[model samples]
Target chain A: DAGITQSPRHKVTETGTPVTLRCHQTENHRYMYWYRQDPGHGLRLIHYSYGVKDTDKGEVSDGYSVSRSKTEDFLLTLESATSSQTSVYFCAISEAGENQPQHFGDGTRLSIL
Target chain B: AQSVAQPEDQVNVAEGNPLTVKCTYSVSGNPYLFWYVQYPNRGLQFLLKYITGDNLVKGSYGFEAEFNKSQTSFHLKKPSALVSDSALYFCAVRRPRGNQFYFGTGTSLTVIP
Candidate 1:
C-alpha cells in the first residue's frame, strides 16, 4: 500500500469483453509495473513502464496491454477478457527501474465468466 | 535473465515456532534478491532484500533473509512465527543490469495456532 492505489478493486466481467484497470501513485516513481496473481502462478508480470509512454511486455503479456500517459497513472487493458484472465492484478512502483525494492498497491480482483 | 525458485508449494508451522521459507535464484552477475509476502485480499508487501554487503538482511515484520552465494540461495527466516504471518510468500531476483524483477511461483505458509 505504498502510496499506490488501484481502481476497481473488484470487477465481474464477461468473456470477450474489454477491461481496463487503473493504477495511480502519489510517489511519482520512475518505474511502474502491472502483474497478475493466480493460484498456481503466484504473480506474473504483464507489463511495465519505465517512463511516460514507455512500455514493455512481460513474461505473461500476451493478452494484455499497458499505457502510461502520465507519471502518476499506469493503465492495464485486457483487449478481450477470457476466463483464464480472471485473477487479481497488482500495480507496483519503484524509484528506479534497477534493483530497487518496489512498492505495491492493494490490487484489483477481476473475474471473467 | 534472472530467475527465482521457491521449491515448497506450502508450509505449515505452529505459532511461536521457528519458520523458514526457502528461496533460490540464478543470475549471471551478482544477484539482487528479495522476499515479499501477500495476505488474503491484499497486494504483495516487501519483506527483505539482499544486495551486496552483509549476508543477512533484516526487513519489515521482523523478517530476515540470508544470502548464501555458494548455494545461490536467499532464504526467508523468522525466529518466532505468528498466526498473522500465515500468508503467501514470493521470492524475486534481478540482475545487476536488468530493469525488471523475475519472481518465483510463490509458497503458501500456514502458521497454525
Candidate 2:
C-alpha cells in the first residue's frame, strides 16, 4: 500500500460526456503517472507529472488530459468520452531516483456507453 | 523506441510446478526492465526490476526474473506455482533516464489446483 487513493472506483457515463478521475497520494513522491489498462494492451501511459505544474504527455495522450497542481494530487480528464476510452485507469507514484519502482492505486474502472 | 513483448497470451501450470512467463524487449541504450502482476479489478503491483547489477533479480511473492542482455529478454520465473499466483503478468521496459515506460500486452497465468 503506497498511500495512493483513486476516486470513483467505478463509473459509467455516456459517450461525449466529460469525466475526470482524481488521484491523491499521501506519500510525497516526486513523480505521478496516469495509465489505462485494456485487454491486449496491458497498461499504457496517458500522462505523467514530474513535479507541481510540470506535466508531460505519454504515448496514448489522445482524448485525455491531466494536471497536477500539487505534489499529492493528479487529475486525469477525458474531454469527450467514447466507447474506445472505456478501460481501467490507474494512478501510480514513484520517487525521483534511478531504480525506484512505481507503486499503484487500486484503479478506476470507467465505462463509456 | 522502447517496447516489450509477451509472446504468450496465456500460460497454464499445475500447482507446485515450476512456471515461467516469457518477455522480450527492444530499447535504445541500457534497458530498465520491470515485471508486474495484476489481480482481477486491481492495479498492477510491482514484482521485480532490473536496473543494474546481477542478472537475476528477485521480488515479491516468490517471483524472479532473469535478465539476458544477449537474448534481449527478461522472463519471469517461479520455482513452484500456487493458485494465488493466477493473474495477469506484464513486462515493461524503459530507458535509463526516460520519463515513461513501455509495457507488453500481458500474459494471463493460470495455476490449476
Candidate 3:
C-alpha cells in the first residue's frame, strides 16, 4: 500500500498482441522498478528507472520495453506478448537506492493465451 | 552478480511453535538483505532487513532476522507462530550502487492451528 497504484489489475490477451502495464506512485521516490513473478521463479527484475528518461535492463529484459517520462509514472510494455510472458508483474519504489527497503504495489496479473 | 537462495519450498509449524525461514546470499562486497511476506492476492509486505551494525535486526509484525556473515545467511524468525503468519515469504539481496534486487524462489509457510 505504499501509495503505489497499478492499472488493469487483471488482463488477458492473445499471443502476438501488445500489452502495456502502468505503475504510478505518489511518494516521489528516487527509484522505481518493474518485476515479474512466476511459479518456481519468484520475482525477477525486468527493468528499472533511476530518473526520468533514465532506464536500464535487468536479467529478464527480453521482449519487454519500458518508459518513464515523469517521476510518478513507469510503464512496462510487451511489444509482442507470448505464452511464456504470462505472469504477475509488480512495481516497487524506494526513497533511497539499493540500500533501502523497497515498497511494492499490488501487481498486475497478465495472461497471454 | 548478487543472488539469494531460499532452500525450502515450504515449511510447516504448529501455532505457538517457533518458526524459521532460511535464506542464504552471495554478493561481492557487503550485502544488504531483506525479507518480505506476501498474502494471497496481495502485494509483498516488508518484514525486516540487514544493512549493517548489529547482527540481529528487528522488524514489523514481531519478526526478526539474524545476519550471519560466516554463513552468509539472513533467516527470518519468530518466537511463536500464528495462523495469520501462513503466507509466502521471499528473501532478497540488493546489488551495490544500483536498484537491482534479486529475489529467491519464495518459501510457503503454513502455521497449523
Candidate 4:
C-alpha cells in the first residue's frame, strides 16, 4: 500500500450540485493524478499536478477542475454535477521519473442523479 | 499519439491452466510499459513494468510479462491460473520523459475453478 487515502468512499447527489473529492498521499511524491473509470472506457485522466500549485489538464478535463495547494493534498472539483459525470474516481501518485510505477488510492464512487 | 491496446475484452481459463492476456502499445521513442490489476471496487494494483534491460519482467503474484520490441507488445502470462486471479487487467504506456500515461480499456480475466 502507498499511504494514499481518498475521502468519501461513496456519494450520491442530484444534478447541478457541487462535488469535490479529496486525495491525500503520505509519500512525498512529485506527481499526482486524477482519473475516472467507466465501463468500457477504462480510466481516463482528468488532471494532474507536478508540484505544489502546478497543474495541467488531461484528456478529459472538461467540467472538472483540480487544485493542489500542498504536496500531500490534491482536490478534484466538479462545478456542477451531471449524470454523465457519474463514475469511479481514482487518484495516483508516482515519483519524479517516467519509469516509476504509480501507487493508487482505493477510489471514490460518485453517482449523480 | 501514444496509446495501449488490450485486444480481448474477456478471457477465461480453467484453474491450473496457463493463462495469458495480450497487450500492445504504440508510442514514439522508447516507451515504458506497465501492467496493473484491479479487483472489484478497488484501485489498480501494480503488477509488472518494463522500463529497460531484459525483455522478460517478473512482477507481483507470480506473474511475468514478455516485452517484444519487434512485435511492439508486452503480454502478461502466468504458468498456472487460480480462481483468485480473476480480475480486470490493464495495460499502460508512457513515453520517455513524458509524465502522462495512456491506458487500455482493460481485459476481464476469469479463472474458473
Candidate 5:
C-alpha cells in the first residue's frame, strides 16, 4: 500500500542454496531498509541503504547482505540459506529527511528446509 | 544502547471499552518513540510517533499515545476498542542523533465482540 512491492511473496528453499529477494519502490525515496520479523523477535534491521551504492549493516546483518543499485531497487541476498534464517522479510523506504518516517512493503515469507 | 519493552504479551478488551497497550523505553538523550501495527501476512504499519511535542500524541484509527519522559514510557491508548483493532502491536525507540531503532517483542491485542 506504500507504493512498494517485494518480489517472491513466498519462497521455499533448501539449505545451502542461494536466494535473492528484491524490493522495488515507486516513491523513489532516498532511504531503504531491510528487516526480518520472527516470533518473539519482532522486527530487526538487517541492512539499510541511504543512497545508491551506499549500504550499511544493521543489528542482525550476519550471513545476510544487501545492495542498492538504484534509487528504487534494493536487493537482499542469502548466500547460504539456513533453516534458522527462515522468517518474514520486509522492505521499507522513507523520504530524504531527518524526521521522515518509514513506509513498508507487504513483505516476503521465506522458508528454508 | 537503546531498547524498548512491551511487558504484556497480549491484551484483551471488549468492544466499546477502552483499551491500552503499554510501552517503555530506555535510551540516552531525547529519544524518538514509535508505535506500529502488523496485520497477519502484511507489513508493519506506522501508527504514531513521539518526537518532541506535547506529552500526548494522536494517530490514525483514533489511537493516541502519551509520552511520559519522567517514566520513560509511551503507552498507546484508544477511547473505544473495536474487533478490527485486534493485531500485533510493537513499540520502537531510537535516538534522534542515531540511525537505528530497537523494537519490542510485540503485544497481541484481542478485542472481543
Candidate 6:
C-alpha cells in the first residue's frame, strides 16, 4: 500500500503496439523503481529513478524504458509489446535514507496478444 | 552481481506450528538483505531487512530473519503459522551502495488448518 498506486491493474495489447504503465505515489519518496515478476524468475528490476528526471537501467532494462519528471509519478513503457514481455509489473518507492526498505504498489498485469 | 537463493520451492506447516522459509545470499564484501511476501494477484510487501547491527532481524506479521555472515544465509521464521501465511515468499540481496536488489526465485508456504 504505502500510498503507491499502479494504474490499469490489467491490460492487453497487441504484439507490435506500445504500452505504458503508470505508477503514482502520495509519498514524496526520492527513489522509485520498476520491476517485473514472473514465475521462476522472482522480481527483476527494469529501471529506477533516484530523483526527478534522473533514471538508470536495471538488470532487465532491455525492451523497457522509464521516465519520472515528477517525484510522485513513474512510468514504464514497453516500446513494442511481445509475448515475453507479458508479466506482472510492480512499482516501489523508497526513502532517501540508507538501507530503508522499499514500499510497493499492488501491481499491473500486462498481456500481449 | 548479487544473487539470492531460496532453497525450498514449497514448505507446508500446520496452523499454530512454527514455520521457516530458508534463504541464502551471495555478494562481495558486506551486503544488505531483504524479505518480501506476495499474496495471490498482489505485489510484494516488505517484511524485514538486514542492514547492520544484530544478526536477528524482526519483521512484520510476527516474522523474523537471521543474518548469518559465515553461512551467507538469511532465513525467515515464525513461531506460529497461520492459514493466512500461505503465500509466496522472496529473499533479496544488494550491495552496500547498490541501488538495485537481486531476488531469489521464491518459495511457496502453505499453512494448513
- Candidate with top TM-score is 4
Q: Please, what are the lDDT tens digits per residue for candidate 3 over residues A1-113?
A: 68999998999999999999999999999899999999999999999999999999999999999999999999999999999999999999988766788899999999999
Cα error of candidate 3 at position A51, Å: 0.5
At residue A27, give the lDDT of candidate 6.
93
| DockQ rank order | 4, 3, 1, 6, 2, 5
TM-score of each: 0.96, 0.97, 0.98, 0.99, 0.97, 0.97
Mind giving the per-residue lDDT tens digits that candidate 6 earns over A9-89?
Answer: 999889989999999999999999999998888888999999999999998999999999989999999998899999999
Model 1: number of clashes? 0
Residue range B1-111, candidate 4, lDDT tens digits: 778889999999999999999999999998999999999989999999999999999999999999999999999999999999999999999899898999999999999
lDDT (C-alpha, whole model) for all candidates: 0.91, 0.93, 0.93, 0.96, 0.91, 0.92
lDDT of 2 by residue, B43-75 (tens): 889999998899999999999999999999999
RMSD after Cα superposition, model 1 = 1.2
Against the native complex, each candidate's DockQ, computed on alpha carbons, is 0.82, 0.75, 0.87, 0.89, 0.70, 0.77
Cα deviation at A27, candidate 4, in Å, is 0.7
Q: What TM-score does chain A reach in every model?
A: 0.96, 0.98, 0.97, 0.99, 0.98, 0.98
Q: What would the per-residue lDDT of candidate 1 be over residues A1-113, giving only the tens digit for each residue?
A: 57999999999999999999999999989999999988778788999999999999999999998999999999999999999999999999998846699899999989999
After superposition, the stretches of candidate 5 with alpha carbons farther than 4 Å from their true spots are none
Better of 1 and 6 by DockQ: 1
Worst 10 residues of 4 chain A by lDDT: A95-104
Docking class of 4: high
- Output the lDDT of residue A15, model 5: 99
Between 2 and 4, whose lDDT is larger?
A: 4
Off by over 4 Å in 3: none
Residue A32 local lDDT, model 4? 99
